[model samples]
Target: MLTKELIANIYKKVPKQNVLSKIEERYVYAFDASDLHEKVQIPDAVVFVESVEQVQEIVKLANKFKTPIICRGAGTNTVGACVSVHGGIVLNFSKMNKILEINPVNMTARVQPGVVVGDLQKQVEKIGLYYPPDPSNLKVSTIGGSVAQNSAGARGFKYGTTRDYVIDMLVVMADGSVIRTGANTIKNAAGYNLGSLFIGSEGTLGIVVEVTVKLITKPEASEVLLAYFDSVEEAVNSVNQIIKHQICPTTIDLMDNNAIKTIEEYKNCGLLCDKQAALIIEVDGFKTVIEAQMKLICDILNKNNAQNIKYAKQKEEADEIWDARHSSMAACAQLRPNVTTDDVIVPRENLSILIKGIQKICSKYDLIMCMVGHVGDGSVHPQIPIDMNDKDEYTRYKLAKSEIYDLTARLGGIISGEHGIGLVKKPFLPKVIDNGAIDYMRQIKKIFDPNNILNPYKIF
Candidate 1:
């Protein structure tokens, strides 16, 4: 419970006009992107902090009062990471969004955590530098949330995830102390490597105030290859074959037939829906290199029984191809009253097996499961359109999800691929993670936050 003095201290420390206690206002901050959880409640007041110093002051008061502090960005998280489970204080950082510095010489950009991903992407692209982590929600998702969740994208196959480019960060530690975690240099062997830790900590350890990420020069050209398969297994086979050929595309994403149908239905685009599965492969580099990669990709795809292949040559076609890919969540979400998206990473060799297993699980649950994901990385998503009003539907969904996770574990896979193990996936974590690893994380949590005041009821 928040005492009157504690709230007063918070009001003094934060922007007085920005603090909100109205029920309707509180309702807006209640839940995040997850639909599995009940309606979120418990934040005593939502305080919008404008600067790093404001974050520090808010953290200090929250620590002193033993109140929960949830660092909220754009609130686009799929897991309950942004949910205030305990009625403490919601540290709203949406006002702190500022692209602080763009160093063209170093090819790095320093940004406040609250900067929206797309806004930064546009800003960086104007200067010929590229920030490639393009989560579907990039238009609205904050970079802080992306870093907190270790967000990935179709480009991850070539460039790797967000952490790979994050060279430095400034974090507000548990005790309200601001510490620079990393250096702008390429290599550093400093103690503990807290920079990497803070990347996917999910707001459990510290609040990220500033982020410095490496940027690469924009590719000279990009090509999108759309290949259709007679069977989903054939599609998976094509992915494995593509990787085996050592021809790494910038992105090789797989979309199931059902998912394609949803996208086509929603967008009214003339997308190929006459296949069991499809591989949307994108390659980028110099014109000659892109053309060569395209030839090799098409040859390998055809060798793997690709029924139909269409290559996009113009900017409109490129955008059309990506538009179908990015609109997946909204298309899938409209299938039912709710949708539970889980990321399960498996060995590339077992991608076909996992797809088959997912089919079985979906059939068993009498649910429609369209499996799609970053096939190049073996990180797939099996989205279940859940009906919130029906308890029995979820009961079966729980079993279906459990079986899928178990199968993934058996195949040397993790419970989460790109998405973090936030509130929704915590229950199934033990199915994939070793007991010792979880124990170690719990111990680390204890050491960093003995009071458990930082984003409680989350990844633990």
Candidate 2:
């Protein structure tokens, strides 16, 4: 419980207007994007800090009161990472949003935690540079949330995730002391790479206030292609054949028949509903090589028995295809009152098996599943739409989830590839990771946050 004195101290540390103590205002911070069936615990207070000094003062108050400090950025994470499970102080980073610096010379950018991922991408692209970590909701997802979850989108097949770009961060520890995780330079070899520890730590160890990320030159040309397959096997084989031919496309995304139908119904993007599966392939390179790359990928698709193919001829067309793909979750939600999405990855070779198994599991539970994935990286997202208020349906969903995780572990994959192990996946962490590794993680958490006040009871 937050005592009156502690609440008064929080109001003193920041502008009174920045602090929210009323139930109605604090209620909004209680949950994140995760569709939790359980009753959520609301935060006692929500505070917005605009500067590092203000964050330090809030941390000090948290330490003094032994309260949990949950860091929230857009609250777009699919997992329950930002949920105020302990009903403590929620740190809202919206006011801290800013792009601090863009160094074209150094190929890096310094940004506040609340900087939206897509906004930064646009700012850098204006100067012929690129930031590759493109989460699906980049337009609204903050850099801090991406760092916390190491978010990666379709481009992850060629570029990489947030973990690859994040080089340094200014983090406030549990005791209110500020520490720079790493030097601002691209490469650091002097000491431990503490920045990495916090990349996917999910706010359990420290609060990240600022981040410096490396950037790369933007591709001169790119095109999107949609290939329809009569069977899932054909689509998966086409992905393997593309790799066998030594062709590196920017993205190789898959949408099963269910995803195709749902997205078409929701957006009317002209997706073929009869196709059993479709591959959304994008190739990026110098203007001279774009045509050659597309031709090679198309040849492989034909050889793998692709039924039909469509290519995006211009930027507008490309955006239309991508917009349809990104709206998949919203489309699925139209089927039921509540929708839940899961991230599970396996070796590329076993990608087909994992997808098939998930389909079977959901079928056994009589659940509606719209599946999509980055086949190049073997990451699959099974989005299931269901009525969470239905007790019987929710029970079956829980069982199906457990079995899906079991199948993933057996196929040599962890439960999550981009999403972090927030509260929703915390119980199954042991199914994929050994107990010894989890113990070490806990020990490390204790070292940084002995009070367990930093997003307490998370990731273990």
Candidate 3:
């Protein structure tokens, strides 16, 4: 039970309307985007914070009461990163969304934690600037959540992930004290790269209040092409061949036969469902070089046994191709009652084996899976649609999940590529990370959050 004094103290720190203490209001904050069916503990209170001072005040109150302070954005993370497992105070950043500054000369943007990723992209693109960490759900995902999970998408093959752009951050430490992670300027040769520690920390060490991200000039021209292959090997080999020819496309995303058919059925996007796999390749650069890049990429695709290659002739067609690729999860969800997605990455050489292994495992377990990935970077996202209410199916899904991680380990790859190790992946962290490294991580966690009040029992 929440004490009257604690409740009163919270109300004093924030506006009365911002404090949510009713059971109905608190219940909604218990779950995130993770598809886990396990019962979750509802938070005792949910507060919509508007300023850094309000966040610090809440952190101080959390320290006094020793309650877990879970920082939340849109709660779109698929790994249960923002779920209130311990039922403490959930600090919602929705009201704090703001883009404070956009410096064209410095090529940087300072933003509040609640700023939506796609919204920022549009605002920056109004100028000639580009912020390139494009998560699949960028339309709804928040920058703070992307920072916590180090989220990446198809563009990651060329632009890198969220960590590459974040230059500085204003973090409220566990003790309600605020600290700047890096300098405002781009180059910071300061003591330690403290920002790196918190970039993928999943809000365990501190609460990110403000962020400064570096930006690059927008590409002058871009084009998208869909290439179908007779077999998975042909698709994988085509990716390698493209790289061997010294051609670097912005994204080389792969979608298996299941994904192609599923998305076609889900949206009738004109995808070739008869092929075993498809590669969605995009190239961007100076307008003068686009035709040359497309010609080279097309020649390589035809040489590698690409059955049918289709290049988007217009911007509408390009958007349709990308929309189909990005809708893999949504398409898969239509096949079953629940859908779960996993991120596993291996070396480019082992890409074919990883894809085949996952397909075989899913087939053996009689589970329906739609596989899509950023093959340019050797990261695959296997989205499985299942009926979670079926006990036998859930059991089989668990077994297949463990075996998939084992296969990933044998292939010399970690379990996660961009998604952080939240509650769903915590049990399997040992499969990829060494004990010594995890021990050090725990020690560091203790040093920063001594009370264990910041997103406790996560990412271990």
Candidate 4:
């Protein structure tokens, strides 16, 4: 409980209007996109700051009170990154949303922590620049959250994830001191690349108040195609052939029959649900080379016995195909009251085995799973829809989840690719990461946050 004097002190640091201390107000920040059934702690207070100085002031206050300070953006992460587990002060960055600067010559965009990813992309693309790190829910996910999780989407196969784009960040350290991780220039041979350490730290290290990300020129042209296969092996063979021919498509996304049927049932998109698997490939480059890329990709797919091929001839058609692919999660969510998605990645050669293994595990558990992934990068997202209220079913779901991670380890893969090891995956981190690495991580955490007040009890 916060004392009256402590509350008054906090009000002195932040405007009275921005401090949320009521039970109802605190309830709003209790959880994020994580499962509602998980144990959640309602924060003592929620504060919104509009400037870096205000953030520092709040951090100082938290230090004095010895309370945890969890930074929040849009709170859309699937791993409970923004959840206030120990419940102290939830620092809301929504009021700090702003694009500080955009430099065309340097191809860099400086932005606040709360800026939406899609909005920044649109702003940059308006000037013929592109920011490629899209974490599926770009419409609502914040740049700060993306950087914290190193988020990436289907485009990650060609352009890397958020970690590759972030050149610098103005981070508020645990002691309320501010530090810039890197410089504005793209190439920094300077001291240690500290920015890499905090990108996926999940707020355990420091709070990112502002970010400067690198951008590239927008592609001149792009096309999308949906290739259907009679079997998963055939789809994997087609992907291998495309890569063998030296065709570097932006994304080679895979959707199993479950995902296709779910999306078709929900959106009525013209998808071949009868097929065992479908590959959504997008090639983008110069205006003149699109046709050749399409032809080469089609040839590869046909050679692998693709049952049917549908290539988009117009921007509208491309959007329709992508919209259907993006709608897979929402469509699966309609199948049950609660849905959980896992990010597991294996080598491209083991992609077929991982997919088949996950499907079999889900079937053994009697759970409904829809599989979709950026197959080109060897990452897969197995989205399972289930009712958490059913005790027996939930028990089986947990077992299936563990087995899937075990299979990923056996296939020489980690439990997470872009998604972070938040509270949900903390138990299985040791299965993928080495013990010495984890020991060093804990030591580093103590060095950065001795009091363990900044998003404590996470990642480790």
Q: Predict model 1's lDDT versus the native.
A: 0.85
Which pairs, if any, clash in model 3? none
lDDT digits (tens) for residues 76-178 of candidate 4: 8888788877778889999999999999999999999999999999999999999999889999999989999999999988899999999999999988999
Model 2 reaches what TM-score against the true structure? 0.99
Query: Cα lDDT of all candidates, in order?
Result: 0.85, 0.93, 0.93, 0.91
TM-score quality measure for candidate 3: 0.99
For each candidate in turn, the TM-score is 0.97, 0.99, 0.99, 0.98
lDDT of each residue in 72-166, candidate 3, tens digit only: 99988888889977788999999989999999999999999999999999999999999999998999889999999999999998899999999
Query: Candidate 1 or 3, higher TM-score?
Result: 3
Candidates' RMSD to native: 1.4, 0.8, 0.9, 1.0
Better of 1 and 2 by lDDT: 2
On the 0 to 100 scale, the lDDT of residue 283 in model 1 is: 90
Model 3 — which ten-residue stretch has the worst lDDT?
1-10
- For model 1, the superposed segments whose C-alpha errors exceed 4 Å read none
* Overall local distance difference test of candidate 4: 0.91
Compute the lDDT for candidate 3: 0.93
